[model samples]
Target: MEPDSYHRIYVERTLALIKPDAIHRSEEIEDVILKAGFAVLQNRKLQLSPEQCSDFYADQYGKYFFPNLTAFMSSGPIIALTLARSNAIAHWKSLMGPVNSTKARETHPECLRAKYGTTDLKNALHGSESFDAAEREIKFMFPNSVIEPLPSREETEEYLSKHVNPTLVRGLTELCKHKPLNPCVWLAHWLMKNCPNMPQIVVEEAEDKK
Candidate 1:
């Protein structure tokens, strides 16, 4: 089915990574993204440093799986992409199927990960969970191009007024004031509230601003 015209007008973007394990299956992954209506804005392959891997997975630092995850990520080269489309995050993740290759194959045989991945950690792909994460992850991976000016105060206020609830607006405003990180979660929540029936991909993209 075709995407809604309104959604097309408000197209969003997200970051997607094809891990080393999927290098041989890159074409298959690209096909999946294209079929999902996402346009590849930028793409590249790089061998990551251990420091970069650790920084990228910092959120999982305290978790038991962090060490292994870091090792796996730094083990080989990876493909990074900037994908543009409506509802990018959720859609991309859906196309990726599950984190565990075994489960993905059984439950979503046609999914990218299911077809190319060898295991859970080597699951051939990585997608930012939210727009904020996408922005951070993308910047961490592609420092040069990812750096851009933050939204101005007036712009932020206007955006909040038009798209967010008063209660949420206040919280998000505070978040911007202190954290000043990407506002992926706040943006996703806003889109969900305003466009409740939008596709998952659209929601994901909305969250992945960078």
Candidate 2:
């Protein structure tokens, strides 16, 4: 691939959480984010319940600081931002600096945690560690947003040929035959009823073994 195309193909998205302690400095934080070449695709302020915080940080559930972490996270509203750029996860992590504020101050004095954070536990920000974590975290914070990566050109063409085109072609053929007054409406209804790619219905046949 050409250099530009390769760079374009590697565009990534990561989730960044402005923790409660830094919510008041959100404007400054956002200015930093923008300056660092991140596109803020979506953002929201959320006041999470302890249960929600626990669920969001499920990987840390059994850790010693779990309870305190959950309680602190639930204490106030934090801003969740969907940031996109090339190498976004690593870049955001670098910008957030060390999780321990004192360590961040020593090693990365210009980092957000060093500038805004007070302690190790309240590091004033959170960033996903990897692509999978980014996907899960983004979905957890922005449930309704579609975070799936776009399929490759080959994949898109194959899917259109195998699934979408056949249904649309058949629908159009039927529409032409009947000459319906509202052709779009007729084709839409026909596709819904006749499309072979209808969503599957899964039935749970047994209770949980556990």
Candidate achieving the largest TM-score: 2
- lDDT for 36 in candidate 1 is 82
Cα error, candidate 2, residue 202 (Å) = 46
lDDT of 2: 0.89
Q: What is the lDDT for 109 in model 1?
A: 99
Which stretches in model 2 have alpha-carbon errors above 4 Å? 1-5, 150-210
Q: Which lDDT tens digits does candidate 2 get at residues 1-210? A: 233554554568899999999999999999999999999999999899999999999999899999999999999999999999878999999999999999999999999999999899999999999988998999999999777774544565566667777777788888999999999898888888886867757787898889
Clashes of each: 12, 0
Error of 1 at 175 (Å): 47
Model 2 root-mean-square deviation: 13.0
Task: Pick out the ten consecutive residues of candidate 1 with the lowest summed lDDT.
Answer: 1-10
* Position 33, candidate 2: lDDT: 99
Against the true structure, what is each candidate's TM-score?
0.67, 0.70
Candidate 1: tens digits of C-alpha lDDT, residues 91-201: 888888899998999999998888889898889999989878877877777777845534543565565456544645566666677663567776556545546245456
